[model samples]
Target: MLKRVFQALSGARPGEQLPVLLSFMALLCLLLSYYLVKPLRDSMFLSYYQASDLAYMAIVVTVSSLVVIKFFNHWVGRIPRYRLMSITYAVMMICKLLFLLILPISGRWGTVVFYLWASVYFTLVLSILWGVINTIFSARQAERSFGFVALGATLGNISGAKLSAWLAGSAFKDWALLLSIGAMSAALGLILLAVQIASRDPETARKQSGTAALHVSRGMQDIVSLFGNGYVRGIALMVFTLALISMAVQFQAYGQIDRNTAATVYGEEFAWFDPPGQHFEVIYGLKKLDAAAQQARLKALGRSGNLPTAQIQELSQSFGRYQKQFESRTRKVLSDVYAYQGLLGVFLLVVVARFLFRFVGLRYTVLILPAFYALAAMVLMFPLEIALIQVLLVIGGALNYSLNNATKELLYTPTSEAVRFQLKPLIEGPVMRLGDVTASLLQIGISTALALWLALTEMSQGRLLLALGLLFIAAWMLAIWATGRRYDQAQQADPPRQELDLHA
Candidate 1:
């Protein structure tokens, strides 16, 4: 049954089954660790900071990512592949252990540090894993097998998200970090075993030797030369534009959450009541009351100005209790969003991705995400209910994780080893973060301008953001077309091997 299922989903012959299965399991654990930590990281940060603060945090993360990836590239030649992977996992585990100890006492700063580290962690770890996989499989093998292997990641994401939500609501919440660490340890073991199995194949062994021999230059120079290639430039543009649009959408979603929550707790008129620097201060002075009392107080404040200090103090005490409830609610909502997103991803990877790859072809498959983004932009043109925003987030996230991700990884299959190890990390890590920084700066600027404009007119920031995102999507689509053309050219130049026989 297992063999038949593997063959049906992946087109893997008997000889190809073991390596694919091992690779699948390794990726499963890798993503399991990542998803487990993701909610915790977001919840912890948002507990003390506003949603807008993430833009600045993204800047710090981008800078840190550059340093981390540069160091990683330097060691690509010095360390053996499997051993290097193991060491990276070990270091991450140790950092998680430190976070476990430090988070409790270090306050908001600790959360900031973890957030930055987690961003870098996911980028670096994913690049390394895919780099290893690219080394193991021939281009033909990767085309058919990558989707099936990626299924493990989808399952792991679902399991991790569900597990994190359960833990957050249960008495075992404290154990979540430890479990994430254990998941990475398991992944490290599986990765080492997979590398060992692939090394036994003579063709794979020869490929690995050739890859190792090509790593003669300093990693920095190789990265510089990679930009000279038009295909690489196209990929970087696509990645950057995707990151920019994603961050903009995320900021809008978070803003909606904040606005909705404030409306519920404060009053309906307070729904659009976004004060520049006085968000918490305003919340502190306003008591949670019925519509009549809230409206009465709003009128009173408008006429009489500031409340008495004693009254403000009393209301702030009440707001503190409300803040705890707010934090708990925020965590639960984020957990649900991530869980549903992962579930959708699982469905797409299992049912949609393979068919698209088989029938749609690479050029068109690359167009799907931008097309979806265009639809999402249309949705943002109207006032969005919280539930609708959550749906958008889940669907958008699902598409990226499933169809988009599988397609992107396959693009790397035809590249050389130096490109895979050195240049790929730089593109995926720092270049991606550079997109986030650009988005942040844009958000900050637009928001500052809008805060003044909103006083006179009733325009939403989402519409403006959508307009900007549509432009980015256009560029993204063009990049995909160019990159797809290059990829097709590469594949034609050195065609894939014949499909393996099932009975062999």
Candidate 2:
């Protein structure tokens, strides 16, 4: 039954089944670990700081990512691949546990550390994970099976996000519990990975184990030399652009969440209530009483320009209720939005995505999906209806994630094992981090300028968002085209590795 399901969904042969399943499990655990804490990390940060602070955090992520990559390259040089992967996963889990233990003692600094730690952990771990997969699977197998493997990642994301949301909404909302869950998931992924590799015969396993004793370069110059290759450079830019588009869509989606939440609570007229300090009280007071009674109460308060002691006490008592109501309503709204996103991902993976990679072709499929969505996003910004905006953003986000993920792995299949291991860390780690930094800084500058312009000119920022989104998408499309061309050139010049049935 499991084989049938795998075959039906992913077009996997019996020979391809085990490694595919193992890769699926490994990616599932990796994403599950990350998503479990992602919401808490973002929400906690936003509670204490402005969204713009993410720009600073992005800078930290970029710098830290480079150092980690350098150290990672060193490990890739010294340790066997199997031992290195195991140690990396174990150390990451230890970090999570350590953070879990110290969070209570650390206070605000803990939030900072968690944010930075999560960022670096995600980059380093995912790069290594994909590198491992690239090592195990041949190009032919990866092309056929990566989308299917990514289906597991999609499900993992949904499961993890839902679990986090459930725990946060439940009465037993504890950060420690969430961290423990993430740690366990990480450890499970590592075990699965080891099993997958070991399941191969000893001879085959040892041969493919490390970098073939290749003298892989190690240093700041490694990244520079890696990019000197046209194919590697193209993949890096493709990743950068894809990350940029994803970032822009994310920024817009978050804005819609804030807007929709306010609209849900205060109605369309809420914007008018911004400047008047008393409007909130007046609105709440009116909702609680008849207009005549409300007018009478206001008149009484207006005479003294202050509330009576009893009235002040009554207002104070209701404050907690108002705050709780706001929080609950917003949580529900955001939950529904995220649930929609997850469903879109599942549908894409289980239904349309595998078809695209299998039939529609990787290069054009990758280009078309995000390009169309980017155009749709640009068009939809005109109305800015919360529902339409949210839905489109969710769909676009899901497609970009799954498609880019599956195709990018295929790009590494043509490279040598040493190049795959070393170059992947630089691309996935520092290059991707650099993309994030680019997006964050761009978001910050655009937001700051828009805020000031809107304050002075009383203009809408919607058009500005649309313009910038379109600009990023244009660059993204160009990157995709160039990368696809390079991929074709490389494939034509050098044929794929001989197909291997490793599990046999």
Candidate number of the best lDDT:
1
Candidate 1 shows a clash count of 0
lDDT of 1: 0.75
Write candidate 1's Cα lDDT for 35-76 as tens digits.
889888877776666778889988999999989988887788
C-alpha lDDT of residue 188 in model 2: 56
lDDT of 2 by residue, 1-504 (tens): 877887876666666676677778777777767767666666655433444466678878889988888888877767777678778877777788787778657756787888888778787777777777776666566666777788777766777677666766777556633554564456456545645654574422543653345455655667776667665676787777666656656666665564345334544334332334444545444434433565566455444546666654454334434434444454445545555666677777667766765566656765866576567766655656767767776776677557667777777765666666777888887888887788777666666785676662212454455466677667666766666655545445445333221112
TM-score between candidate 2 and the true structure: 0.79
Q: Which candidate is the best by TM-score?
A: 1
- In the predicted model 1, the residue pairs found to clash are none
Give stretches of model 2 more than 4 Å off: 1-5, 104-106, 175-217, 259-336, 380-383, 447-462, 465-469, 486-504
- lDDT scores for all predictions? 0.75, 0.64
Point out the worst 10-residue segment of candidate 1 by lDDT: 495-504
As a whole number from 0 to 100, the lDDT of residue 231 in candidate 1 is: 72
TM-score of each: 0.86, 0.79
